[model samples]
Target: MKVNWFRRQHPLQNGDQLRCHALAKSPIPAHCLELFQKSYPAPNSPLSELKCVVLDFETSGLDPKQDEILSVGMVDIHYPVMSLASAQHYYVQSEQVIHSKTAVINHIVPETLIGGISRHQLIERLVVSLSGKVVIAHGAEIEKHFLRHLLQLDASLPLPLIFLDTLRLERSLMKYRGVMYPDLRLTHVRQQKGLPPYLAHNAFADVVATGELFLALVEEICADKPPLLGPLVLRSL
Candidate 1:
């Protein structure tokens, strides 16, 4: 993502300069900038060296503004080292309605929210895990909008997020390769790639499935060259 690396001898720099230089290029929010100011990783860090986190959310509806996120699930992968055992799942408590249509998709019973964490607390935990990591999701927009809406409650909330969307990535790769598929749904793409089928709608299962799919697809895009996460995001664009 940094082109000047080849121009100079790569002058030695401090961490703040590296993070600020990268943050300046991207439209990161002020809240995010504050949280990552002291610890943001180098923007040019290669994918093989970055910490990756795959995220999935089961929501009451598709609209982030209208509906609510019922649960969140995520797994961490440090390139060649995947930490499946370090996965985290959280169910959010809400006073809002959960229609039967929503239940059918997410399988989240209203009873599950009896002692679930408050939306406030859930976002707190989420941001902590997401800090200084490359977050990934199957359909990035949903996650993006939801987090923005939830975390924008006040100036104290930091919703610094950009996800590598496997769904978008698959579409780009297919177009680049001159291949067409019936659909871009998670299950459909997984099937086309010879990946195992997974039960849809469970937050944990969806993220686990997405992580595997991303690893498989990235192999094609990177080929023999070492992949840089920032550049890969651009390739999808």
Candidate 2:
């Protein structure tokens, strides 16, 4: 009797299912586990003083629990120049074959990331790189979900770093306005506001777009008052 390799209990693809099973069976490194459990800053922790890291991730699939992250990109935003020199992008090498459809969407092929670092190493590097910074992501739920799974993989994983969703900020900015665009897509919003075009599916490009959108929304929200970053809340209609 032969067992079907693809007919596993989980819906995970072959490579991901194999990696998940392996991680579950083996003891994860104690030090690596410790880093995951590290703590982050709180809301009252002085936003002005805190560094903001804009992040974006392109993954093979949507499920953070099952799908693998193919690439991670981030840019450090500290006002002044908004320099690209502070950006970081990592591609993860995976044994999993890239689905043709997904590849068409994300434009990341296995061959493209062949000599890149591993997922575990990428996570470790990201953790260290993002330390002592507030994380900003456009439509942050996906990123948060991914981070949650990463933390859960190691029990000692700390809570997520401070997070600000640019999607939420954009939504808040449009709340009081009478005219509303039919589509709230990021690209649509950028174009409507006369902002630069972003090549979708590229993590670095998305991060830069999110950063610009965040700044634009902030300016709109802080029109009457001295510019300050705070909890951006949507006013009820």
Q: Over the stretch 1-237, how does candidate 2's per-residue lDDT look in tens digits?
A: 114855553221332344444445656555344433444433234344557788998988889767878888899877423557988888888777899998998899988898888767886887777766667787787887887675455543324355677776666666556546445677988887799887988888888888887667666766655443334422111
Where is model 1 poorest over a 10-residue stretch in terms of lDDT? 6-15
Candidate 2 wrongly placed segments (more than 4 Å): 1-47, 153-158, 178-182, 227-229, 233-237
Collision pairs in model 2: 36-157, 36-158, 37-156, 37-157, 37-158
Cα-based TM-score, every candidate = 0.80, 0.75
lDDT of 1 by residue, 1-237 (tens): 344653342221233444455556555555445445535444466888778899988898888778998999989998856688989988999888889888887888889778888986886777778876778898888888788787663433334444688988888888777877637899988998899889888989998999998888888778887877656666544
The Cα RMSD of model 2 versus the native structure comes to 11.2
Task: In candidate 1, list every pair of residues with a backbone clash.
Answer: none
lDDT of 2: 0.67
